[model samples]
Target: MEKSPDAFRTISEAAEELDVPQHVLRFWETRFSQIKPMKRAGGRRYYRPADVELLKGIRSLLYREGYTIRGVQKILKEDGASYVAGVGRGEIEPRKREGEMASAPPPGMSKPAPRVKGAKGEAAPAAEAPAQPLLPLGEVRVVVNRLSENHADMLRAALRDLGDARRILDPSQGR
Candidate 1:
């Protein structure tokens, strides 16, 4: 089980949990100015719970809601703290006009359902017909083997050229 960020996670751990890169988190720190994680000796970053939550909000805004980095920065500058708190506390609700609920997708244009795995470890459709089986493993293996052979041949040719150059440079070994 993974510990919460309140216990302080290394930058890599935070990035892994948040599904973002360490450089991205560093960039966000520069942009948002609210994600100040603790930097230890040798400049190792350790993220707190608040920082982790802020990262989650930023990710949701960027990836899920499709907000640009600048747009997210502006949102953070305006109401980021409160929004983060609200989302963390699960107090975020869609604000609709009286008696109006969020609209559903139009008929025949619904989002695809998640595929469920069958007992044989194959993906079965949630509804409707099962998807066609993918290309056989044997076919994929043959393709990979061919590619590997080509790569090995190229490497060998390059190495031979390097050896020739070395022999030329060290003239004592006659060509």
Candidate 2:
């Protein structure tokens, strides 16, 4: 049974309201660390109103707006949680580039300022940035058989797991 919309909700309730399966909610928590819900003693997730709104924005970005997970994360970090959550409330719109949807944000919620570039057209550096060192790469090819389109999500998840394993095992990854 569904509870009042104004009240805090469990994972299942949030999933139902968002029209997504429960597992998808769990998956989003793994991909997006910004989603921090309250946890009870037994590890039960209880999402506050803000968390729900953020999740809705994330869902709209990924499923309806066709944004990749990394793209949404960048938007959240650069634009802020309120900005992304505004997308859920239909107050803000994600900027879509060439070959993407052209819907606009509501008035007064105009798109954020464009990045300023230097003389050579390179964007200005962020105020305080972390040291991003590149890892050494070696080509080691692997062949997989019978990966069908229906299993694409599973394949991507497996690839992500493999990447995590690689980062952990390889000392030079610097993750």
Q: Using TM-score as the measure, which candidate wins?
A: 2
Q: On residues 28-94, what C-alpha lDDT tens digit does candidate 2 reach at each position?
A: 9999888998999999999999999999899888877767798888888888889888998889977
Report lDDT per candidate: 0.66, 0.77
**Which candidate tops lDDT?**
2
Q: Ten-residue segment with the worst summed lDDT in candidate 1?
A: 93-102
TM-score of each: 0.49, 0.54
lDDT of 1 by residue, 17-75 (tens): 88988899898888887889999999999888777877887776666544568766777
Candidate 1: C-alpha RMSD after superposition: 18.7
Q: Which stretches of candidate 2 lie over 4 Å from their true place?
A: 1-4, 98-175
